[model samples]
Each structure stands twice: as C-alpha cells, then as structure tokens.
Target: MPIQPQAAKYKPESPILSLGEKIGDPVHAADFPKAILRFRNDRWAEAVGLDHLNDDQWVQHFGRFQPLEGTLQQPLALRYHGHQFRVYNPDIGDGRGFLFAQLRDHAGRLLDLGTKGSGQTPYSRFGDGRLTLKGGVREILATEMLEALGVNSSKTFSLVETGEDLIRGDEPSPTRSSVLVRLSHSHIRIGTFQRIALEQNSELMTRLVDYCLTNLLQPAPEGVAPPIALMRQAVENTAELAASFMVAGFVHGVLNSDNINITGESFDYGPWRFTPHWEPGFTAAYFDQTGLYAFGRQAEAIHWDVAQLAVSLRLLCEAEPLIAELEHFPALYQDSLITHFFRRIGLTPGEREASLQFIESCVQAMAQTGTEIDRFFFDWRCGDPRSPARYAGEAWDKVRMEAAAFLPAGTRDHPYWTDDAPCSMHIEEVEALWSAIADRDDWEPLNQKVEAIRRMGEAHQPRLT
Candidate 1:
C-alpha cells in the first residue's frame, strides 16, 4: 500500500453526540447488489490510522458502512436547515449522506469521515440516496484539482462503485452509481446552527456553541464572549476560503449556508467549475439564474452566508460583537485575496500598496486581453525564472516588470514547469475523460489526469492555508 505515514497514532472521538438528539438520527447503510472499490486514499487512510486495512476490509467498512472499531456505532444522518440560493428550506439536511465516523488525524486534529452516496435518511425526501458513478468520478476530479491548486478542500478519501442502475433527469438514464467517503475538519455547518436558532432553543444553541469553540477552536479570551470569538475565527476562515476560490478560478456553484462548513474548509463540490479566465460574473451551477454566487461575487456571497451564521448566533448572545465580526469579512477577504494571489503566482508580498495595484492591473489585463486563467499563472511560475515565459509581450510588460522586483517564492526546477502546456481541467476535457470511462471502461485518462494534476501540485507546492 502507498502511504504517507504521520507521527501521531489514530484517535477516535464523537464529540458531536454531546449535542445529542437535536442534531441527527441514526440510519443504516443501503443494501447494494455489488461493491467494487474504485478509489482508495492511502495517504489519508494512514493519517487516520486505517491504512492497515486490506482492500476487502476497506470495502467492508466503507462500502457496506460497517461501523469502524471505535467510532459511531451507527451512522448519524445529521439534520439542519439552510437557504438554497437565497430561499430558506427548513427540511434540508444530509439527504443522501451521513456522518459515518469521527477521528483525529496524524496531526491530532479532529476529522469526520462523511459519506455522499452511502444511503438515504429522513432528508432523502423523494429521491434515491444512490450517487451516480459519474458524479463520484466528477467529485474525485474536482477535489483532486482543488487540492492541487492549494484550495483548503475536503479530501476525497474513498470512492466505491456500488452495483446499481439509477435514473436521473440531469444526464443519461439508468446511470451507474457509487459511494464516496470524504475526510474534513468538521461536518457542523452554518445551517446546523440555523436549525437550532429556528427552534428557538437557546439552551441547545449554547451547547452547540460551546462544542464548536471547544472542539473547533480554542477557549475564548478573558473578556471575549464565546460567540464573538468563534465568529471571529469563522470570519477569518471563510474569507480565506473565498480568496482561495477566486485566485484558483473556482466557481463553487452553490454557496448556501448548509454547504458552508463552519470550520472554513470548502466542501460539497457540486456544479463546480474552473473559469477559463477572470470573469467575475461566471457561474458554476446552471440553476443560479441571478448570478448570486458568481466567481466575482463569491466574496460577497460568503459574507452574506456568514452574516446569516451571525444571525443564528444572535440567539445566544448580544448581536453587536457578532455583527462586528461579520463586518471584518471585507478587509479579511481583500488581505487574504492579495496574500493568495501572490502565493499562486510564485512571488512574495512586495508591498501592500504596490501588490494591490499589481493585482488589480493583472485582473483587468486578464479580462481585457482574455488571457486564459491557468496560462497566465503557468507562464509566470517563479516569475519565469526558467522556460514557459509566454506572458503578454508589450501590453502587460509593466505588470511583468513589477513582478520581477519581487523575489521568487516557488521554484521552477520541477519537470512539470518545463512542460509545453500547463495542467488544465476544463469542463470539456473532464466530460471527454468521463466518456472514456463510460464508453470503453478505460480508466487511464482519468488516472493520468490525476497524476498530471499531482505533478502540477508538486510544481506549485500547494500549501493549505
């Protein structure tokens, strides 16, 4: 087995249960005709102390939802409510997924093993809980690409193709189905808090708030209220998430409260897309008719989403400090955007004013000159310390000249930097990759894409913020 062993041993815990019955209900995994393991993440498995399991053991635990030795005895289908594209839905939760297990990684940080297509619960409503195989594949691709690009995204821990044929309106009928397992910092979303606030359960809200501050963050400062401190941490995190997405050219299709993890890590990849260039109005989900969560508006969208989180927190404390924290989002996002933009282009933060001007100029240039997103960054890797110096010749010379003043932060020695073309994962290319899997059961293209993406990550040296 390929593994990246860490120093700390496996540690299991279920602190969410401390919130008790209000959060969720236990549910059994679906009975499938077959369980074929397609993807296994030994790197993360080792971190969580499951890398020792053989493939059969892996499928038994993940595919069949057998309880991990010391985790949740039964899967908990979490309950929460959220605004779906600005419309509130009180009856929305983990419809096709559930929290399967909770444990600490090698770094001693709490991580939840959640599912995407394991089965249905109270939230399934009118649909089958099965995830189409294509959807599973797409998620793997999305998470892999996002991680490679240095986005703090959920890890696609395992993907197993469960034998089943499901019908759907979105694509071809009777599509293949599968189950996906992901590892992330926390499953408690803003919607989770919103659900409590809706119930007007102040006691439970306080309990949940304490759970977050204790498990997700440190103790509140001497004078700081718990809600205010938690809100501040969340504000910084969500701002960083928005900045990472924008700089990576990612459009998260859905920016609902439920999809926003309170831990600030990006999760739930649906209707996601990478922009061809810097178009602020670009959208990922087709149903987003108003462009509420467009690429350019993501920072605003997250601010709005977190403000709702602050509203949820209002049930437990005074609104002034919470509102104050929400107000910090704009400055937090701009500073974070500038920070990540420099990291993305392999340069240091030269000077705040100069860096801001250069970034604005680059964004404007990319828009006016229609420069491809990855191409622009690829050409300037290590500020063209090596080959691939294909930046705009004269029109952008001043910007390039300014970039030269900053010391290089990323090395161009990786073989990937010498390639004729940058690693790209456009929708067109992804669909073509899926066609190969569907038509000929050829997995090489998808595998190759994952490898190439990892190589690109090696070249960029992605560091999670």
Candidate 2:
C-alpha cells in the first residue's frame, strides 16, 4: 500500500502542545478542535478575516485559504433529500452551507473546517442565506455547553459578528447577523445518501458510501462487504449516537434525516436542550407538540431517523438485514443508561446485582416524586455523608428544599405559589436570582458553571476501558 504524505512524517504531538495550538493568540482563541470566528459583517464576507482582510482585500483572502493545510477543503456540493416534518422535501443540498477545507490539528488528527451562514449558492432557493446573530450566538453556547457535558459534538470555530443588518422574528428588531464557522471530523449526514437514494441514483450512492468508508469508517478493511456494508456501519453509528444523547440528557429537537449523520456524532445544534430535570416529556423544541422528539423518546427518534436513511439504501438491497442492524439501538441504549445511572450515584468499577437494584430505586424515587434533576446531582455534590439521606424526611422535603434555590419558586407546587407566593421574601429573591442564571444572555455565569462541571468531570471514573 502507498503511504500518505502527512502520515509519512507523522510525529505524535504531546497532548499539551496539541491542546495549546488551539489557543491561537489574543486576537483569536482556538477551542480544541474548533476555533472562534473573528467577528465581521457583510452578510457573507469575501474573506474569513484570517489575515485581517478588509472588504476590498477579501478576494485575495479567499483564494489563499482555499485548501487549509490539514483539513479536506473540497468544494463539491453534496446531494441529499429529506423528510422535513414527515413530508418529503427533496430539494436540499448544502443550501447556503459549504465545506471549505479540512486540516490536521496539532494532534495529527484530520478535522474539517466548514463555514455556515457564508451566503448563497445554486441551492440557496428562495432564502436570505443569512443566519440570525442570535442563532449564531446560541449555537456557540450549545456546542460549548454540550462538549463540557461530554457529548460528541461539533465545536464552534469562529462566530463572525458580520456587521450586516438582517431581519428575523423572535428578536425585538432587525438585528446584526453573523456567519458561523465550525470544525469537525466530517459533515456528511444520512440525508446526504438519502438524496441520492431518492433519485434512484444507485451509482452516486455507491460512490458516496465509498467516500465515507475511505475517509471516516475505513475500519472494515479494503475489500469488506461492499457499499451495503457501509449501511450496516451507519446503523451502528446512529445507535451509538442515540445512546450518547441519552446519557448526556440532550434533546436534539430536530431528528430529520438531513440532521442525522452517518458518523453518529451530534452535528447541527438547533432547538437543542440539556435537561434540568429527568422528566421524560421535556422537549427543547417549542413546536415539538407531537412528542416524537421528547427527551425520553430521543433514542426511538434516532432509530426512526436511521430507518429513513435505510429506506434510501434499500432501493438496492433487502430490508431485513438493514432492520436487524437498526435493532441494536435498544440494547445499546440500555447498557449506556445503566452505566450512566451508576455514575450519577457516584458508583463505579464494580457491577454488583445490588448496584442495579440501587439504580432502579433512585429512578423510581425520582419518577414517583417529581424531582429537580439538577438539584439531585447538586445535593450529591454537597460533600455531606448525610446529604443523600436527607431526602428520606418529609417525603423528600430536604431534597426539595436544597433544590429550591435552583428552581423557579412560582414553578413550585403550592396552590398559593403564585407570583406573590408568600415565603421568606429574601430567600425567594435569592432563588429567583440564581435560577435565572440559566436564562442569562451573557457567558460569565455559564462559564463559571462550566468550570465547576469540568472540575467534577476530572474527578469521575474513567469513561473508557
């Protein structure tokens, strides 16, 4: 076999240097696999400002950055059709997004550096091709928070505060828009193949499968089960993704085939949420009225989404084999759940029958009596041997009281718990203040919480064998 150029000179970077290079400099700071987009404005600027190019200088900026040194910067528009809310929307292709380049990081790992909100293309259709600044800001937060929460997520590269006026609802007025650039392993989605399948374009689908296997899933060796084998690999990827989301308490909000990826990594961030409580019914999408994408139903949603991807592949193969591959979801989810359940209780290494029973007890306790999810963990972090036992009194009253600071008082279950509910007004005010931390637009509070969570993660049992 021929050797690849970069691999020939491969020298593993010390983990410290690998991580340090991402912190570029003061003008720009890199966050691990992704970096921050320097803020600019032109709706879709001619330059990424990597060289600090002004508007007129962007054309020079464009050609020079064409193929970033280590990432795949191919400029081919990918094909895909998807069911948007159960209706066939067969006309999606990168739309306004493009994979600009791929590069290897200091870690010697190849990562894709793609830009979204970069403006229009042949697939732009009838849209502004501009992303709202608020959405851009939210995506940055979602990626940062989810990474800290230990989910396999796309890292935010640069959030260019492109100083262009754009109009959108959910905002007080027309606001300055932005172009968000992200870095990841791959941007290939299940919908990418789904598009070719819907066209009955098997040749294209085969090429797509080959491309993925060569680049992302080359584990099966050179001459494995052919293109169809990739279909099986894709199934496994989706299953693992569903399990990860379950463990992380993440609600993807949109499970459309196009939003799902063959690699099983969480890619797009939209209407997503990290649960504050363990309620199975919690939904991040205000519009997910059908409950198909609720917190508890995420695994099933992923299964259904993957099945839709299989439909495209089935045009050239039997359904039973693909369906069998899809069945791994439940078992995978169960194993992942039990493992996480133990960690939440601070138990690890040993797997006794009693451990399972204890986990079941905790789940039942939380279910029987509605408990604040974040508070349950916060109480565990209280550093008191008596902390867990306090929940035994007054039917879990102490747990509720300790959690009181974290939940909205009005949301408490008192018949008189109105806006004017009577209590130690000072305590009520304090709770209101701290609870609002989750709703803040600024990063100071969330940043502090992230640091604390990181400290906790450092002390946890190793996640891998």
Candidate 3:
C-alpha cells in the first residue's frame, strides 16, 4: 500500500524471485465485494513487522491484496502437481491461494505470507477459487491447537470476511466466504519437486535443491551432496511432524503429496478433526472410507509421501543415497514420537527403549479405557518425579514406573495444570463454537477458545525447535 512504509522491525524479502518464472505465475488478487477483517494474528504479525497496519490497512493489504512495500510487486500463484489419495494428478497448483509477501520474523527465520480464497489463478481449474468462512474458521482452530501441542504448524495470519454467497455440495448452499492467510517457512511442496522431476528437468531440480539448501535448510555439511542433505532433513522434519500429530491426537484429514511442505510445516487444513480417544482407525475426513490417512496410519502415510520426494530427487542424484536417508524415517519417527510424548507430559526422555515402551503402554491404556487424549496429557504433566506406584491392575502401571526415571520438564507452574479439565478441541467442541457464529453471528466463543489454547501453550512452554 505504501511505497516505503513506516519504520518496521523485521526486514522484507522476496527470496522466491531468484527461482524465476518457472516456479509460479504472476497474478492479481480478486476485488472482494466487501473487506471485513475478521481475524488478525497480532502475535505473529508483529514478529513479521506487519503490526504497523491499522484496521483499514489490514483489510486493504490482506483483503484487497495490495502489494506490500519491499516484497513481491504482485502476487505469485505457484505451480506444482501431486498425488491426491494415492492417485497421481498433474493438473493442480495454487488454484485459490498465492504467495503474497515475505519477511523476516522476530527469530530471524524467513517467512512467507500465503493466502487461501484470495482469488482465482490459471491453476483454478474446474472449481471456484473461494474458501468458505467455515473452512477459514476450522483452519484457524486447527493451526492454533496444533501449535499449542508443539507441532510445527503454519500460523493463521489473517482472515477477512468477503461478503459473498457460495454454493457447495459438501455443505449447505449459500455459505459465507473469506480469505485466509498463513505465515509459513516455505510454500515449496513435495509436489513442486514432482513437477520438476516429472519434466525430466534435472537442471531445474538441481536449482530447486540448491535454493532449499541455501534458504529452507542449513548449509549442507562438507562433502555431502545437496540432494542427500535435503533427503535427510526432509525425512527427519517430516518424521517429527507426524510424531507431533500422533501425540496431539490431530487428524490432518488430507495426506496428499501436494499438502506436504518440503519444510515439514503442516498447513492447508480441510475436513480436519480431533479424535476423542486412541482409535487407531479414526478417520477425520468422511470421504476417507479406506482410512488410508487414519490416526494410526499418519506416520506411514507421511513416510510414503516422503518416498515420493525420494523418487523426485532421483533425477538429481543416485537413488541409493536418497534411499539410505529415507530408510531412517521409521526410527526418526519413533524417536520423535517418544520425545513429543515426554515433552507433552513435562518429562525428559530417559532410555530410548524405555521411553518407547512407556509411550506404547500409555497408548494401550488410552485405547482400552477410552480416556480423552488431551486430558491424559494434561493430568500427567510433571507426574510424580519419584517412581509412581504401579497400579495393582492397570495398563499404565509399567508406564508410570518407566516415566519416573525421567526427570520432570517444562514450566508447568501455570494455574492451568490445576484445572479440573484440559483445554481440548474435539470435533463436537469445534462444531458448537462454529454454531454461535453461524446462527447468531456471535464470535465470543471462538475468541475465548483461542485464548484458552494460548494459555495451554504457555503452560506447556512449547518448543518450536
């Protein structure tokens, strides 16, 4: 909106420009019927030096999509292809969203501000490029909850209610519309590589690999091929992501290769649900009849998606090296799962084998007794530093003794730890909150829920690393 805005804290960037036009399309944002600023992520906005905008400016930039100073002169709707439900599709890309801007965050990490329902691009094939207000709300909740549980998730940057009526087969007709923006480390998807490799463009793939190594990841260690280092990083990052989802009891609902980011941050929420208990086959999307991306199979699904990345990387280097790094996913996931569980309960990891057995026993107890997963984590925070007594006849008895050997962790002194119940976002709770906004236009419940989630995050002292 401004050629050179007022003094800002973070530096502006357009690093994606270096990749050239092959990566995306230069596009314009749709002029909305109305620009109603429904949500503003001040916490993260300030980090990216965007908190300087007032309400009107916020709507003008995010809702109307004006070019931000020192960032992209225009929006870029990116291009890529992916496997949707294991069926490879080559025609899809950023149909509804585009990379709007980029900047450094408070932590000095490069961040991209991308949008959903901003407008239609050449990629918007066979469908309207609009996000329902309900979809926007759900994404906000999903990201907030996942972040609180220590998952590496994109922050829901902004949501602007665009006054438009849209008809959809999935939900009732004449639903409201909105634009959602997400702050993420990268918009580079595994599908991006698929598109490049599918073209047999090894040179292009090499350029991308170098780009990721320079910006998305730390420099490759001496004597290591960039492709090999990328495989190792993606594998470990993806394993940690899957493990966090398991520990948080989150069901992403969609595990397509296009949905998976090369940086391993989870975004693009749709038909997501939080499980009530440890149901291994619990499905989040109603259409997932096969339970391919079910609660328990998430790790396996992510591992498969990473394998596709390996196939793409085959263009750049020998498959042997990629396969070698890919082979580490299972063990990396196990370690990540145990590490996340221990962090959830405010305990340090002790023996690797012991931690593994302890987490499994806890899961077994959850499945058999039907304890709400969130409550279990909340109740057990800082569980007796001394060896907890074994239950006379309980599944968690062995787990209790095993956890006792690990020291307590985290700043769990928040009053939230003493509450009668934990802050949880099961599907029912989500629907009830949405009901108020849909029926009476009351947003208080949604506001309060976000605050509660934040408090829970503070209690856990979530580690972004």
Candidate 4:
C-alpha cells in the first residue's frame, strides 16, 4: 500500500532560531537506498494538516531527507549537553536525529517533526547514527499506550523500514534498520537550558527563557520575571506529567535531563515499560542496574530533572526564587496524582481529600492482592458491581461507594463499561506482537493491536457532565 500525500493546510515555523548558536550544523538523512513505509499516523497527520501527502512525497520528505512543503529547507541537528545518569556528559546531542520541521496544530500549538535513525550529525560520535526497526516499533507501541492512557506523550508520526541489517549488542544481531519521525509539542529540553548554562551564556539563557515564555508557555502575570515564571510552569507541568506516568503504570526507563522536554510532554520513548503488578521496583531498561528509574521512583526522578532545570535557570535568576518554585513540585505532584487518577477512573471531580483517600485505598488494595494495574481500573471503572470484592474491604468499599455517586449519568450505560477487560500493553503481549513481525514478517498483529488500543482510547474518552 502506497502512502498518498494530503493537502497541507498549516505552514511551518522555526522559532527555535531565536536562540542563536544554540542549534548546530545542518545534516542530511542517510540515503538508506531503500524506503519501506511501515507505519503512517494519518489520524495525527489530519490534525496537523498533512494527511494529503502521497507515498512518494512521504518517502522523499521523511525517508530521503527532502524538505516538506513549506517546511524547513534543511534539518537542523540540535546541540545540547545532558546528564545520562546524574553524570554530566558533554558529548550528547541529536546524533541520529534532527529537527526536521515545525508546524502548528488545529489549536495553534507549536509542534516539531523530529527524526530518529535519520542519519549521523556532528553529535554522532563513535556510533553509526541509525535506529533499529525493533526500537522504532517499541517506540510506536509506547507512545500509543501512553496517549491512550491520557498521558501527554509524543506521537510516532511515521516509520520507514530502511532496508539494512544492523548489529546490536542489546538485541539479536543483524536486526533490521528503520527511521522514525516523532511529532512532539516541542523539542526544547531541560538539557537545552543546561547547555547554555554550561557555556555561561546568561544572555542566551535569558533569550531562551523569553522565547519559551512567549511561545511554549502561558502568559505570565504582570511583574513576574520570565525565568521565574518559566520555572514555575515547568514545575507544575512536569509534576502533572509525572503523575500521569504513575497513573498509567509506565516506567520511562531513562529520565535523563535531555529526555525531559521543557514543555513537560513525554517524548523519547526508549526502554519504557508498563508495570505488570504495581511493583515499585519494576524497571524497564536492562541497564538500569541501580533502579534509579524504577516504577516507584519516577516522581523522584522527574523532580531531580526539574531541579536541574532550576539550576540552569539560576544563570538568569536568583537561587532563592528558583528554590521556592522547586519546593512546589512535591505538593503539585500529589495533587496532580489525585486529579489524574480520578480522571482515569471515569469519576467526576471530588473533594481533594476524598480523592486522595480513594487513591490511597485503591493502592493499598492493589498492593495487598497483587491485582493487575490495568485490570483493576477496567473492572472497577464507574464502580462496576462485577468487579472483584475480595480486595474491597471496608475502607475501599466506602471509597467505591463515594466514587459511584460521582459517576456521570451519561456513562452509566456506555457499552465500553461492559467489556471483559481493558486494553493493556503488557511485556508478554508486546513480545508476542514483535515475535510475529520478526519470525514471519507479519504485520497484521501489530496493526490489530494498535486498532484495539485506539478503540480503548475512544472508550476511555471522558464523558462530559
């Protein structure tokens, strides 16, 4: 099946250039010599006004490094420094990826079309800047599951299987190669600020802060400094994002500074996993030997990343104000957890204290019984009577009863409520899906899984009061 280009409606924008010298040399994607279009996110393309691109044009732009209509003439390989695991590393940037283009969605939010495994750049030190097909597939699955779970996450825009055999130490040798385009809110990361701070370029730091305040963030109140304002917004949004990850049972594997987008959206999905049994120590990355990014420690990890952001902002603002803003993360994260958890369970907003109690009781029950995280929500959604009562002790019973009172009347008879189980992206299921692709070159299973995840997303769409 050939991909057809859709009539593009929105024009591209390059606001990042406002921070001069922050971005690096121009780079072209690898001429993989083969372009096999494996996945195209038409639904998202429609939202971004690129649904009319034909297959050839799609390959030309995304695969062959040709510029999209009204987009960047040449991709920019962004430069930045990041702390891989609490250790600062200066030799890190878009080694295998670059910011291909930027455009606005229907709501006028700025979005970036960035590439992975596209080619090597100045940042591609001691590595063949390419992405494994398995890595691309895993990222698509991760983003799909996160979006369906109501987490603000990047969407896998397009995936092309570049016909090449690459050897990797992590997976089986001679694995297939691919190129991926991710549509994200912004490519600006915490490390972007870190890089400027490292250079002691306070002028550029101020410019970057101003750019983010004017473009990426909400308008600040009168008399509020842009750096302080940006830090506050980042704290709030990062807290909300961390809570969403918790409620979704996701472990991001690596919560490095570079991976933490300044807009607070979840991007750069690698070695991510959904919790199987709500275990706190569950880890996604095989290299995470110290459990620094374990399931339970995600909030801690994100808070650390935000603190690093505050450290960067100190170049433009006083440490006292920034420290005060950083102090808000703990409470904000707790409040957001309660809010997102309620939203996930399909319950109308309740008193803050009540919501907290409900979440605590549910967590206790799940921990005691080892209930599957997704299944617990699936069975107990809207206080369904058919849900397991074994773990519904007196405290949880009251919680459920209260939650039942807040269910929207419109959802009482929704057909999705009657489904036996919620759609889940467990590791075993992910392995099975990948096995079909690897063993027989069958893609039907992956397609079916994505459709099922989408249907579940539709089912979980919150009902209006």
Writing each residue's lDDT as its tens digit, candidate 1 over 174-198 gives 8899999999888989999999999
Cα lDDT computed for each candidate against the true fold: 0.86, 0.54, 0.88, 0.84
At residue 310, what lDDT does model 4 achieve? 92
Q: When superposed on Cα atoms, how far off is each prediction in RMSD?
A: 2.1, 11.4, 3.6, 3.3
Please write out the lDDT profile of model 4 over residues 226-310, one tens digit for every residue: 8889999999989999999999999999999999998889999889999978899999999999999999999999999999999
Residues 316-428 of candidate 2 have per-residue lDDT tens digits of 67887677767776666566665554443343413444444544555555666665554454344322212455467554554344333321211122232122211111223
Candidate 1 weakest ten by summed lDDT: 1-10
| Model 4: lDDT to the true structure | 0.84
Ranking of all candidate structures by their lDDT, best first: 3, 1, 4, 2
lDDT of 1 at 189: 94
Candidate 3's residue-wise lDDT over 1-465, tens digit each?
111113349688998999889999999988889989889988787777888899999988999988899999899999999999999999999999999998987767788999999879999997688999999999999988888888899989999999999899989889999999998989999999999999998887888999899888887999999999999999999999999999999999999999999999998999889998999899999899999999999999999999999999999889999999999999999999988898898888888898888888888877776778887787677765222332334677766677678788765679997777889999888899989999999999999999999888878774648
TM-score order of candidates, best first? 1, 3, 4, 2
Q: Which scores greater on lDDT, model 2 or model 3?
A: 3
